[model samples]
Target: MTFTAAALIAASIAPSISNAAVKSEGMKVSMQLAPTADARQQVLTQSAVQFSKEMRRLWIEHILWTGSYIVSAISGLEDQQQVLSRLLRNQQDIGNLFKPYYGDAVGNQLTTLLQQHIMLAGKVVDAAKAGNTADLNKYNAEWHKNADDIARFLAAANPSWGFKWLQDMLYTHLKLITDQVVARLKKDWEGDIHAIDQNEAHMLQFADVLSDGIVKQFPKQFQQ
Candidate 1:
């Protein structure tokens, strides 16, 4: 499912909006003609496949870096900040994916939300490390609230992404993260490894849902 250089260029330059021409006030001039429906559909199909692959790659990186951050942070390792920086960048990358179909503002908004999600998770890790039960409970609650905010934001953007379903998916993702953290804290090495495996699989599924919804909602933006 690789795109050739020409195909990549075509997708890059394709119109973000629909092909329909708009009329100016008191003017009857026609704009540039659009591709035929058949041609447009073919381009969209190719682009959609590529988008799915990209989404999967991004989500895989998200979980892998997050796991790395978790390990570094919990063990008081020096690379914690570096792993966290990479993980935060992944959030921005995920947000940028929406800019083609939505816009920069929306993309930035998603990036902010996702970064907050990561930061809050870090707080949770810190609390757990310090044996601060009160802060752990507080940060955990805040973390779930951030997840809710993310689900709501995405559901608002695409009708295909139902709020409840997105919420449940996000909550499950949080639980998986929590599982890994708890397993690490308790010296349950097997459980931590299993949690990482589950988290990767779950994030991939999450990526697919988002990719499918975007394709279904704005087929034109995916032109090859």
Candidate 2:
């Protein structure tokens, strides 16, 4: 698990900034290129603390939204609104994490966009609970649109500070959830197999988006 966590953390860093320059800086800066094992452990420990704090906030939103549509909740999802509420809380949880990377304005803007998405997604959950497929589709469309808007902001920022490795980790986690969601829903309902297949394909597409972003922005990291 720590290896997985570390991989995710490593992936987020902005790919060695400027291979030759960063390497040169890294060498010349000499903040302590060599450290005792204890010192290295301490650094890793601090990194893990910060990483876990951010990841946990992400986990909260993931659990709330994704869990809402899980098979168990299909019958009577009274907590549909609660899921959105949890999302707001999750937003606050990760507020500080964003500040170090994006400062106040961008961080707040991103948070606002995320909250809007949560509100729209909440409507989808509400529609689903009511068995209103048409309304669910409408809300889903809005949700996707919001997602696209958020992606644009992220792309504009291009957050090169190794933040993307975390995205790969997140994408991997999302893939797992999508796989389970499709399998569980298929078993629990008689929905079209084609829909499940499409959903799975979409998950792959999303992963590709993340991968493409990483490779395009940080080709050197890929080489490494």
Candidate 3:
């Protein structure tokens, strides 16, 4: 994002004076004011820190709710739908975070993609539960494709976020999620816990990357 430098000027001019005994004199004064570079940088640093924290919080919520939904769905728990609803809402929350930087349309597009990701994950879980290899494979492939689309969309918006890097991160995210599902199905509690721990750490890193990219892309917004 680019910012136009605007000068705020205040000026005053003394009234003209005419007199035979005194020399006429005129005075003009003007001043332009703006924040100092150091002040601006301080504000930018604060904003970046806040953004990083918020992103980490949101992404961490994403993984936690998702894990809850996975456990509920696999175990045929009564609160599965409620957990799923909360998990889906996290996707919109993440998208809303982008609106200030990317506008409503772009934010909504991301929400759609993330919603699709969640829905595809549901299908994969169902297929796995039902022992349907064909549907599981199909939905898993589509899930990966959705991840690719998300990576492409973000990379197009900010060059600081490299496509290959984002893609790899998203792929790893998917693998961790799959590991959780597989471990749960196999009744390996320790493995499931490990995957959950890894997923949370991975998503925190992902959130940091996203925050850094946004800070780079729109430096002016973060300035004083």
Candidate 4:
């Protein structure tokens, strides 16, 4: 990729702008050092796309297996800490991906929200396992509330990622997970399979939505 004359000029000019503007707008003068403008754009665009891909893969793994792990733990077939540790690591990985874009402070905030989500999910699993209907109801509500908070945080960071859409998608995610948990508890094999299928499809779409939002919001950085 070769940097065009115009790109070189713009990149050079960016630094002379105010420090606050440079930080807030994310002017990437270094990116213009690439052989071509498209090369830099490709790197950034692909990174954003891969962020969604990695997150989707991680969450899909959670959706597919976390419930089963919880079931096993509850039945004394597995250790609950193993599941929590794995999910926590995954959440940290997801959070780190955002650090390049949002910086450490905001990235850690996202990680904390995500950690809470995983913890609330664990509580839901425990309540269900114990067959404590009241606790089950309470934890389930909290889990969804955490999802709302996550959605709000994301929407605040990137207005192009609509609050309503993210909220709806995240709520749908929680509902699908709930369906799977309920089905498994009831031994409804058909329902469990259906919920898994729906979740896999929906989760991929959610990832795409986030990726698209990033591309749309930062078109200048992505355009060749």
> Which candidate gets the maximum lDDT versus the true structure?
1
TM-score of each: 0.79, 0.47, 0.80, 0.71
Give the per-residue Cα lDDT of candidate 4 at 202: 68
Model 1, poorest ten-residue lDDT window?
Answer: 27-36
RMSD (Cα, Å) of model 4: 18.3
Ranking by lDDT: 1, 3, 4, 2
Per-residue lDDT tens digits of candidate 2, residues 43-154? 2234444444444446444454455444334445576456546657665554544555557887788778767755664465345445454675576556555655665666
lDDT of 3 by residue, 110-209 (tens): 9999989999988877777776656766777788789889989998887667676677677667767776887787777897898898778778767877
- Ranked by lDDT, the better of candidates 2 and 4 is 4
Candidate 3 worst ten-residue window by lDDT: 4-13
lDDT of each: 0.74, 0.44, 0.72, 0.62
lDDT of 1 at 143: 81
lDDT of 3: 0.72
TM match of model 2 to true structure:
0.47
Runs in model 2 with CA error above 4 Å?
Answer: 1-49, 64-83, 159-224
TM-score of 3: 0.80
